[model samples]
Target chain A: MAGRKFFGHAEPREIVAFLTGGIFGSGLLVSGMIDTKKVQGWLDFFGAWDPTLAFVLGGAVLPMLFVWRIAEKRKVSVLGTPIPPRPAPKMDPALIAGSLMFGAGWGLAGLCPGPALASFAIGGWGGALFFLSMVSGMIVAPTVAGWLSSRTTS
Target chain B: MIPQDWIWGALGGLMIGGAAAIYLLVNGRIMGASGILGGLVDGTGRDSMVERLAFLFGTLAVPPLLVPLYHSVDTHITTNPGIIIAAGLLVGVGTRLANGCTSGHGVCGISRLAPRGLGSTALYLLGGAVTVFVFRHVLGVI
Candidate 1:
């Protein structure tokens, strides 16, 4: 049953996934994060700085703070799946370096993972190009990460 | 009146987190967008490919449908293929190496106040600010 496809299930696993995805989808659309210029404006602290993203971050975090508490106390989810409590997150070189790398990319184009996907609805060459390139980049990431890990360890 | 951008953004933010909460409570999975895509594409989550693909499909499908409501989903990304490719590659590589992104680390991790999540989020925020200063302010090239 756990191995069942999303739609294939009689249970609500896939339906929940779809509904959440819709929330995330419309959230981006509503928030105007799909607007690359606005995203850039949020990053443009030195220029005409737009503080909308700060609010977005703050608003997004508020609910999740409560969600984490509820999640932490739960043994199983409402859908009857195991809810694993997260441990103390470890600080490592990869975390430092990778975060910086991702930030640079995000600032460069003002497109993060969620916005990029949401923007796919626009049906533009720019969106298609970026999405494909990002996917291709993800495909090779493990190899790059593996090499980085080996190099750092050695 | 409060700026529409902030109002809409906050409302959307609440929705985003609300959706994530649903995913957490109902699906028992962290609602990190990059991790979902990265896991599936990278084959690390091949076993859950069904679920991941379904999530991807839903998110991707729902946005276009909202066009009737929101009118347009303009992303305003740069047309320069060079910039697009470079940015895409960097995002992919960086997120995978660090193991999270804005949704994962920024929203999910920071909300929980986890060390790695907090640390990564700080570093990326700094990285983004510095990059914007150098590229947008200094070079004037996006």
Candidate 2:
């Protein structure tokens, strides 16, 4: 039942998602596109800017489109299991609230989850701090949000 | 070893990707960095504590070992540690509120063509655009 709901009860959706993310991350690296400096510089458009980042994203995406097409045509689960695509979200308050918070954080830190994790390799106090706080945030926010949701629902 | 500049970005992405793959293959998990780190601190997932800690440390440490191979990147960041921490906290909040981060939703979820990921990634992009505008333009951080 659960399988059918999310991925057609055939293939393990988690495996598919994991491989998808792995390939995507690999794509980021191959393109030299995961660099926060590159990402930040791209964000710094109009001043000291390098717009090559868009090309990187495009390059990564174009290949992904082909992969998706092949996967769809085969209709065989990525892991030989039936999988249904997960549901998309509606434009609601959660998106609004989340987007605002994410934007504020990313704009300031210039370190989203991907680049922040990547930062750890550089042996900087900055990466350590970012990871620590990000971990903390991960632990704390969910519990607090869950509590808040319970209260609201109740 | 490797060249400078690309060390952190390349090594980090590979390690993270490798970990994600292992988790999926072994535990049937997606290996979202945020989710793993969160599970580590809060014990949200069913994995044993030792495994979780190992996973967390592996995620955090492997990349640093490769530092000798890469050069430093010149990105603009405030020297203020306080601001960086605060920003991380806010991102954490945002991830929880959104139910996933870029890896979880943007890469993993979107790759699966999940609808939630599509909506979430769109918002994430928009939010990123708006924040950059505010910081670099309105606030003139640059």
Comparing to the true complex, what docking class would candidate 1 get?
Answer: medium
Worst 10 residues of 2 chain B by lDDT: B47-56
Give the number of the best model, judged by lDDT. 1
For each prediction, how big is the interface RMSD?
A: 1.5, 6.1
Query: How far in Å is the alpha carbon of B14 misplaced in model 1?
Result: 0.4
Q: How far in Å is the alpha carbon of A37 misplaced in model 2?
A: 3.4
Instruction: State the lDDT of candidate 1 residue by residue for B92-123, as single tens digits.
Output: 88898888998888888888888888899889
lDDT of 2 by residue, B19-121 (tens): 4444444444454656655665666654433444444444444444444654643324556798779878878878767767766666556555667777777
The CAPRI category of model 2 is acceptable
lDDT by residue (A30-147, candidate 1, tens digit) is: 8888888888899888999999988888889999999889888886899888875776667877788889999998898889888888778784998888888888878988888788
Return the DockQ of model 2: 0.26
* lDDT string, candidate 2, A36-86, tens digits: 556656566555665554554333333334444454565444345332343
